[model samples]
Target: MAKNLTTLALASLLTLPLIGCMTTNNVQPIATKPFVIDSETYQSAGKSQRIKFIVLHYTVSDNERSIQLLTKGKVSAHYLIMDNDDDKIYNLVPEGERAWHAGDGGFAGRTILNDTSIGIEIVNKGIQPQYKDALKDSELDYHPYKHFVEFDEVQIKKVAQLVQDIAMRYDISPKNIIGHSDLAPSRKIDPGAKFPWQRLHEEYGIAAWYDEADKQFFMKETQLATPTIPEVKQAFRDYGYQINSTAEWDKASRDVIYAFQLHFRPLKPTGQMDIETYAILKALNKKYAGRDDFY
Candidate 1:
């Protein structure tokens, strides 16, 4: 009996750990005490919304490579839209979790955008694949690789729907919907000039658009004198571009201008300040000022 009791005690002791492990592995919540529920009627004002911006990017490779890189590699996106004929969008990472896209960038006075933005990576080869063949015998030292691949109509439609759904859910402002190049102008340029900003704005209302009337008015009034460098820089800043507001047309300013032009004026992103670019910046600033609801 004594030996049996000792054996029973050892078995119980060993089984206790298994029971603990089983309880720990279970998904349900475990309460240590009987709890009484208390209801609080008042809501606290200390909380704020988690999501604020939506940044768009284009994977510089095919869909398979994009998936491998985004999944196994260091970088990740909340969503990935495959460049197929069908309407399919893959959710690689959950919306509630942060993705490693939009590294070292800011917009609208917000930096480190991964914490506050939902990143969507579209699977599209950014530049022309035939760039080498096209520029084989050119005397030009620099090859202006064509970065204007047309996104498939079906893919774009799916992207528009997904963006609209996310915007509605998070209350993300139209102005806050931006491209990867828009934020990290210095180091990155994906979702380049080819991505249709105007269509998304005009048709889907997912992004802010430059008012045509405002553009026409600016063009009519400023026919003779182009906007000064300082003026143009200020306008870019007012429109939430991360650029220096200086009179000198420096490299930083040029990079930001290039990014802005890629988004607003894709046909001519010369990286040089021109009347048209300045006017567009002014219109964007005027229309979107004090309207971005991020709190």
Candidate 2:
């Protein structure tokens, strides 16, 4: 009887191990959490318009510094092409969503800039004071105090290539590509005079250009009559400038002139809209006469 009981006990122990194995196999695993997207992520808004323009700006901070500030801080961008030796491109903001670059501005009769455009902030220090941000001229210290940063040759190439990519991807027009300061002149002066707007226009076919073909015709038109305040205001509005027009001519005109200088002739930027500016605007207005088709 004892032997029989021992045999039954051993059999039960063997069956218990199999039961435990079966229980382990039957237990199901929990599902992982779904991914949450950042606000910067480009969620499809059902439709996308052809990219009209590429607005340019300067990051103002160094690559490492920019990364830190943008990552931790609330500030962000659609893309950041560095001015470093390597000149790598960093995309902080997605193309589908708007980036917080253009604060208050108008373009081609459009307002509230963030939604309609893609901003590219190249690493640069714009309009630095003569004594400020100067590097110590020493190789030992990587970052000097107040080192004025400018876009290097490599940086420009990187910008061109990336701009080309964006232009191609979104069908961005060469005429529409512009700078931040172009749309919002009263408040900002960035991607400043030292940065190359002409090269982008002349070489890369970015932004409006004063084509040689229209030079004589434009000159004749400007010389025909002194443009009146209302006419000037109308021209500004027709070209997508944001001005009350009720404001004094000096203030309103300066806004338009500043916008022009930032995009075309950044070197002098006196905001006077001299004969050179008058000619440029006439050319642009002629070129973009039918932008509603795209917008």
Candidate 3:
């Protein structure tokens, strides 16, 4: 009887793991609707009106979720660039009709943006933990938007190429192509610092770039040091950036900083001015002023 009891105990223990692996009636896959439209008149901006901006953003969700949420889920974009390992892009919203991306956005002294710009939401998290030295995506399981995101290199290359393609087609000046935070500073922060703006500039030249020398601090000592508020403000203005220049800093200022960091100094984006940022600003300002033949 003792041997029989022991055998039963072992069998019960083995059954626990088998039961764990058993298909539960509760965990079945939910059916996803095939979200599609005729895709008619998607990019039909007329000859009279102009395409002024190419706003960049991160989906903050997995590509699949992004598609579901944006198109089928009411929120949408003129273009949804899902550049994961597969390097795919979907045009969920038509460019001419103003996609629902850039929710409550503004830019260049204007309070409205969707009417003048094309929105592209890339699939990315675009945030880091409070004080961590680096982004640990593997540690992410609880974020509201990161439940399905798995970003990689292919996504980036596709972003640059797609940005270049759209900008060229619409005759949007490189300076006009900006991130979503650039448009609505106080309200949004997607396509955060980890994004490779420099790579886009170097490989595709879609956005602005500074002298590689300006990327490091010591390498650029005499570079645009002590730039006056007027100078900084003017530089931002020339690039068509909006600035409040308030007595007390507000959310709008931080938004522009987020935008600037996404474009230039993406690694440590506190929106605080540093040597590299100053040089890049000065260089960009000078470029717009026709100081450089390239500009």
Best by lDDT: 1
Could you tell me the C-alpha RMSD of candidate 3 in Å? 19.6
lDDT of each: 0.82, 0.69, 0.65
Model 1 over residues 25-88: C-alpha lDDT tens digits?
5667557775866668667888767888899999989988999999999999999999788756
lDDT of 3 at 51: 66
Error of 1 at 43 (Å): 1.7
Q: So what's the TM-score on candidate 3?
A: 0.66
lDDT of 1 at 230: 76
Candidate 3 has its poorest 10 consecutive residues by lDDT at 140-149
Report the lDDT tens digits of candidate 2 across residue range 115-231.
777888777765356634333543321122233345689878887888888887887666567777667777666666666767876788655666655655776777887676677
lDDT of 1 at 44: 85
Off by over 4 Å in 1: 1-40, 132-146, 224-226
Q: Estimate each model's TM-score.
A: 0.82, 0.72, 0.66
* Model 2 residue pairs with clashes: 109-240, 133-146
